[model samples]
Every structure is written in C-alpha cells, then in structure tokens.
Target: MLLKSIHHSLDELICLLDQVSDHDYTKSCEALSNATIGEHTRYILEMFKCLENGYDSGILNYDYREGNNQIQTETEFAKQCIVEIKMGLKSENKTLYLEKVINGLGIRIQSSYYRELLYNLENGMHHQALIKIAILQFENMAVNEI
Candidate 1:
C-alpha cells in the first residue's frame, strides 16, 4: 500500500511535467523566492535517491544527495530518476539507521526501510504541493487532480 502511494505521487509529478512547457518548467517564480518548478522536482527525486542509497548501506543521510542538475532542468531525466527510485523500492525490506540531533546532541536510531519510504513519499508530496503552487502562479494551470 505504501509503495502504491509513492508510485501514485510520482505519477502525479510526471503528469504535471507533461502538462508544462519546458520553458515553464524551468521558469522561476518570484513569489516562490525565485525557485523553479524543476528545482523542486529535482529535490524531491534526490530525496528518494538518498533513501534508496540509505536502504542499501544501512545509513540514511539526506545531506549526501548527488543533487544532479540534469534532473532539475530535464523532465526526462527526472522521470528516469523516478523510475529508478520505484525499482529500488521493490527490493526486500531491511533495517536502516539514521542520525539525528537532539538538543544539540547527535544520536543514532534504528529505522525500517518501509518507514523511510513513507518519509520519502510524504516529502515528495510536500514538494509537489510547492510545485503545484508554482505551476498555478506561472502557468495558471491546476495539476495533480486527475
């Protein structure tokens, strides 16, 4: 069920991409602090990539993302990354570890692969909402409804 939700979110992202022109995709919105929709989409994809890498290595670090610029500027590249992320999520579940700072103290905690996937799903949706707003502001089109 969680995987299905992630897939659906990614599909919605792709649908939004399909509806926008390349110029619009790269257009930065002043209301959004000059952040382009492509940049938001790229950040979402990289977060999933970080989870996938963390799932394999047992350590999930959001700071270690590759931050591929191609994924930001090219819709096809972003779509490919989404496909790769879905393929990675199909692997067997495993225990993952993450570090967090609590009151300025760093601590490591055990986590599950599925839970990280859920985090990525939610994170992706949050960015998607931002992207939807940028789309509305710049293109005057609604996305992710159908």
Candidate 2:
C-alpha cells in the first residue's frame, strides 16, 4: 500500500510530464536553463523510487558499466534532463512556475521520505544518496530563489 503511494505520485508526475505540451516543454527547458532547480528536483524524486522500489511500478534508475571497475554516472543524464526541458519550452515566468514546481517538490519529498522510512530503511542499502538528492534539491531551490 505504501509503495502504491509512491507509484501513484510517480504516475501523477509521469502524467504531468506527458501532458507537457510543446509549449510547456519549451517553457520548462527555458526555466531549467536560467537557474531553475525544479526539473532536477523532480528527476531525483523519481529516480530514487526507481532505486528503492525495484520491480514496482516506480520508474527505476539504472546505470551500465562499460569496463571493469567503470561505472556510468548520472551527471550527464542530469544535464540532459535540463537541456531537454529547456528545448521543449521557453523559460517560464520566474514569479509563478518556479514557485509551483518547488512547492510540488516539497510535497513529493515528504511522500518519498515516509515511503523510505517505512519500506526502505529496514534492511536497505545506504540511504545517503537519497538524503543527498533531497538536500541538493532543497538547496538548489533555495539557492535559486535568492
């Protein structure tokens, strides 16, 4: 049931992403480019679910290893997400969209944090990444707002 909430929220997010018209996408991209942290914050929330809830409806983040002791990082992917968002839409008006996305992230994080505490923390791997992601998102939003 708990995982279902994450899945539900993920579904909502996916739907929102899907519903992004060409205009919205362009706006998102523009917003992302000019000191916007909303997209990154969202990607982290979804990616964390993918890591925590495997085989579930949640979209899981996966990385491939090219060679021995070589691991792919999400850095490129993160940058791409921003670029992609920018490509779709011209940047949004700072006074409104930023506030909305940031507010949405706060709600999503609260949902995920509880889900992790309920299902993930018990016999789970290091939760540091999740914490870091959340902190970064929070920090990014806060930093941009200033």
Which stretches of candidate 1 lie above 4 Å from their native place? 100-106, 139-142
Checking candidate 1 for backbone clashes, the offending pairs are none
lDDT at 59, model 2? 26
**lDDT, candidate 2, 12-125, per-residue tens:** 333333333332222222323432223333434433433433323322222211121110123333334434432332221111111113544522122333443334322122
TM-score of each: 0.88, 0.28
Worst 10 residues of 1 by lDDT: 137-146
Q: Scored by CA lDDT, what does every candidate get? A: 0.83, 0.31
Best by lDDT: 1
The positional error of residue 59 in candidate 2, measured at the CA in angstroms, is 19
lDDT for 129 in candidate 2 is 29
